[model samples]
Target: MPDSSTHPTISSAFPLNVLIQGEGFPILCLHGHPGSGRSMSVFTNALSLRFKTLAPDLRGYGRSQTVQNFEMPDHLIDLEALLDRHQIDQCLILGWSLGGILALELALRQLKRVSGLILVATAARPWGNHPPVTWQDNLYTGLASVFNRLNPGWRWNIDTFGQRSLYRYLIQQHTPETYQYLAREAMDAYLQTSRQATQALYKALNQGYNRLADLPKIQCPCLVLAGAGDRHITPASSQETADHLPNAEWRCYPNTAHLFPWEMPNQVLKDICDWIERNPEVISFKKPEVRSRGQ
Candidate 1:
């Protein structure tokens, strides 16, 4: 397993905690909303054996400093600064859920710098041509908040029947041990995430954060992995994203949900490794040089 200890550093004037391990071509792993860098341990630990992995706890999540009010642009700036500070000219990105959306944005902004993209259980445009935020969505968010407040650590507390039921429903296709482990880690990260940050991100998503039209702008190789049983971001949505990309492949895992990476770690690892091996050029792709004002 990759070292769980995260080193704190300043990026874009904001304190961020990042987990860096192994040594090879870089792979940046971005976790989903209400999740920290630790949430990506399953993929990071396995990938670290062959490639350097950098998983950062995004702003207002995990050990990173919290911001009262912010938008998606702030996160983009932070990511760019992180890459600059690390002196990484190019790297592959593995993004899950909300992180996948950010990955697309980063790839668009830094066309050459982002060598490849691995989008898991996410969509370029969440809700897929429908209204961004519906009443059901609002109700779901409200209920989640109320549940979090009413039963602290309920998601991971499997001793009680209620907790176990909720855990099983939210996280499917997991063994008893895997369920316990993932639930605990996910709950811990969720507890640390700032509620304000969650709301801000939700608001941003509601404000028409669609990237279907922008998918063609990202010309790098992309692998879209989706879970057939995913309810949050349906497989259809993921397929749409893959279809729009100029160069992309799609794969759907059966009997898996949004947390499929954790449920089927070995398969996901093999798929990613195989894809990277097939696309050797991702490591050697050169970034376009920026000439000074008087070149």
Candidate 2:
């Protein structure tokens, strides 16, 4: 960890509650659903030696500005505003789960701004459509899907999400302490926020378009991470997406589940560091876009 005595939070930048820490190459970190920028602060801090990290609590989550009507576009707007506030034209992106979806969207819209990608525990399509997952994963996902339609915030409860059936399937690698810490952090993110906006944000992820065809157009080097025991996105989903990216390396850690940043911090850092060291081209100040034939 890189000097963690002080808690860093910024409220004046583009109305976004951001955690700006470290001092090195800029790298934007994105957290998953039902999570806030605080959840990924440890991971970002670990990388502080090699990169300056800026993580924003997306609209309606954490201490960030509450959103009344949230959607995918809203997140994109937030990201652009954040980059503009910093006057960052291009930089590396580290997106976990839902954040990966938005990163992909931003990459397509502004390819010039993406120097590289670090996608973790994400899929090319919606969670429901992922393959090679247990029936238990599918069942809970199905129930959550239907419930989200009627009440998008039904899964916001810590008790409900911590149920043995659902909790066991999401993260298999944990201890009494780690589990408790993660559970509390997860609940705290939604403790104070707009339920309507958060629900809409959760629902919007499922409506994303197919991006498999666009993967090859990414010009920068990429690293796709997966957990062999990931029950949510599934290892197969990550593998499939990695296969499409023209310049990418796929690494799936054994016995790990979702939330690799917390479960396997050292391993995550090592792999990311190694990838960055090997691919200096990804860190170039200006990486040209790769125009597909049709475009």
Candidate 3:
């Protein structure tokens, strides 16, 4: 097993905490909303054996410093700074949920720097045409508004039936042991996240963020993984994303929900590894000269 280490990149606004492991072609792992770099360990740990993995706790999530008001572009800037600081000219990106959206945007912004994309349980445009704000959204937002003002670290108790039900919805297929383990970890990451950050992200998504038109512009190889039982981001939505992408391979896992990575870690890992092996071009991708800002 490859050992992992957490390194903090100091920035003027806030420090970005990254978990790095292994030593080979770089693979940047981006976690979903309300998740931390720790949330991506299941994939990072396994991929680390063959590729260098850099999983960062995005600003306002996990160990990273919390910011009061920020937008999605802030994350993009952080990612760009991270790559520049590490001096990584090119790398493959594995993005889960919200991270997947960011990955797409990054690939678009840095076409040459991003060799390929692995999008899991996410969509380029999650809300499609009409974005609905559910009761759950209200609940979290209301609670966050109250709790965040008092204390950002304060978290809602997971023992409640409502929280339990939400967990079940997020993770439908899981063994008793796996359920217990993932539930605890997921809740911790979720609760630890800045409430303001969640609100901002939700607001951004609700504004009808759609990338269907831009998908065709992303020419890099892509592997889009979806969970058939995912209610949060339906498999159909994922399929639509794949359909629009110029070069993409789609795979949907049966009997799994949004948290399929935790439910079926081995299978997900195998699929990713197998895909990489089959697509050797992803490994031998040539790096282009770094362009200066505004080039």
Least lDDT summed over 10 consecutive residues: which range in candidate 2?
1-10
lDDT of 1 by residue, 1-295 (tens): 0111222233445656899999899999999977989888888888898889999998889988575776666677778788988999999999999899889988887877899999998998775222355565555544543454455434433333423343343446645545544555677787898976787788887787777987888888899998887777888999999999999989999887778887788898899888888887766657577899987
Better of 2 and 3 by lDDT: 3
User: Which stretches in model 1 have alpha-carbon errors above 4 Å?
Assistant: 1-13, 128-164, 285-295
Clash statistics: count for each candidate: 0, 0, 0
lDDT (Cα, tens digit) per residue for candidate 3, span 174-256: 35444444544566677779976787688777777887877777898999999887878888999999999998999999888
Q: Give the TM-score of candidate 2.
A: 0.77
Better of 1 and 2 by TM-score: 1
Residues 236-281 of candidate 2: C-alpha lDDT, one tens digit per residue: 8888888988888999998777766666677788899899999986
lDDT of 2: 0.70
Give each model a TM-score. Answer: 0.81, 0.77, 0.81
- The RMSD (Cα, Å) of candidate 1 is 7.5
- Cα lDDT computed for each candidate against the true fold: 0.77, 0.70, 0.77
Q: Can you tell me which runs of candidate 2 are displaced by over 4 Å?
A: 1-14, 128-165, 180-184, 205-208, 287-295
